[model samples]
Target: MSSAGEAPSELTGAFIEIAKVTDLGATGESETVVGNTTADVSISKDQTNSETNKHSQRRSVRTKTYNTLDIEVPALLVPGASQLETMGVVDSDGEEIYGDVWDACRIHIYDKEPATASSPAQTFEFENVEWDWSEISLPEDYGEISFTGWVHGAWRRGKTATS
Candidate 1:
């Protein structure tokens, strides 16, 4: 809430943490550790609609059809390789590992530095992400080998550390 004379709070792209669930123990709970060499995060929700008309009366219906998240990051040999593998990307051993639909990972994007009392963070727990990018690219002007993936999943978003 803001007073009449005060300007509204604006959210900025800063303080983001992206993690992948690496393990699910016997208790069925997974663990997530922050990813490295990440930049340019994007998330989207898409809906589809269908309409039926009878006797000049129109009935419209809409449903959530797709939820996707994309991120660009420098390629890492260790953790990044494993992360991609979890998303069903192929490994060096010519094996593909996949997670169940119930599996999920956490993504936290903050409006400000975390622990700042004034601004809250948006956390997305994404489930069953299907990887859309498999190849890596190296641009002429860049030193980092960047990789991008389009992930399709169901995500829940909520504010954290709200005032």
Candidate 2:
């Protein structure tokens, strides 16, 4: 009865390893998203001067550049279905996906568990991500992380499939 996105080993402390977009940048097939994890990258600027001098207009700035990879993972995803289709759950011919199918990712993030052939302190490749479970068990708790905005020809860098 192994579930919760089926751990599949390799996850120690702060974690994040996901791959789609045809294994984005290559490295160990990819699919290990653990939590209590937080990683944010930003560079969103292209002028918004003053939101039309807002008193209510509310449009200050931030053209794009977002990776809000945030969530709690000890209970991991709502449960079942290959840990909920590796956090994007229901695809690859399982059907049952709705809204925000943005999919298109490449992430290798680790603040720990890396040494023998290490190099995954950071990497980024994002395209319309949607690791949004939004409600995966709360009689307890768990799950989130998505940020690939601000377009600069889209960022990419992945190659940490150590051994």
Candidate 3:
């Protein structure tokens, strides 16, 4: 019998596509994130020029649902990296300001370079995202769209070469 290992296929993996860093404007103000998918949207018009413009839109998305069990996995993280820290909105005195997500919410992370102990560093931006998932799986069981966090460990290794 053959060994119990499945051969690798090029189709199975998660990769980062859009990478950029940007400020969330001034505190208290809101920003919008448009993705490659479109289910809902906002429209703005320039009356002076009589032109229609797309304001805020919920484009296409691949949403995932998770419950308490998934959270316990520990390795599963939104946006997929453990290095991402959560920063909440604070007031002028640095007091925490709580906000509500009436609809879906936008997500943001600070820009940082990918680094290893002795490897060369590469600069990259965190993703600022907006998404909704009321249609994916269950309603109350849905979770945040995992951005680019689920990186696999064996990614750097390849099949051994033979003559």
Best by lDDT: 1
lDDT of 3 by residue, 1-163 (tens): 0132321221111211122123422333333332211111121111122333355645543333321100001111233112122212223454433421112122122122223123212212112222222222211222233221221111112211222
**lDDT by residue (tens digit), candidate 1, 1-163:** 1122221122134555555653322344655543432344554333355555566656655554543354444442334454444444445563543322324555565665545735335655555554433454423332334444444544455412212
Tens digit per residue, CA lDDT, model 2, 13-112: 3555544553433454444542223333332323222223456866665343432332223332233455445445455665544423333455566776
Candidate ordering by lDDT (highest first)? 1, 2, 3
Q: Which candidate is the best by TM-score?
A: 1
TM-score of each: 0.50, 0.24, 0.17
Candidate 2 — which residues are off by over 4 angstroms? 1-16, 19-79, 91-100, 103-106, 109-119, 129-153, 157-163
- What is the C-alpha RMSD, rounded to one decimal, of candidate 3? 19.5
Pairwise TM-score winner, candidates 2 and 3 = 2
For model 1 the local lDDT of residue 11 reads 17
Each model's Cα RMSD: 8.6, 16.7, 19.5
What does candidate 2 score on TM? 0.24
Give the Cα lDDT of each candidate. Answer: 0.44, 0.40, 0.22
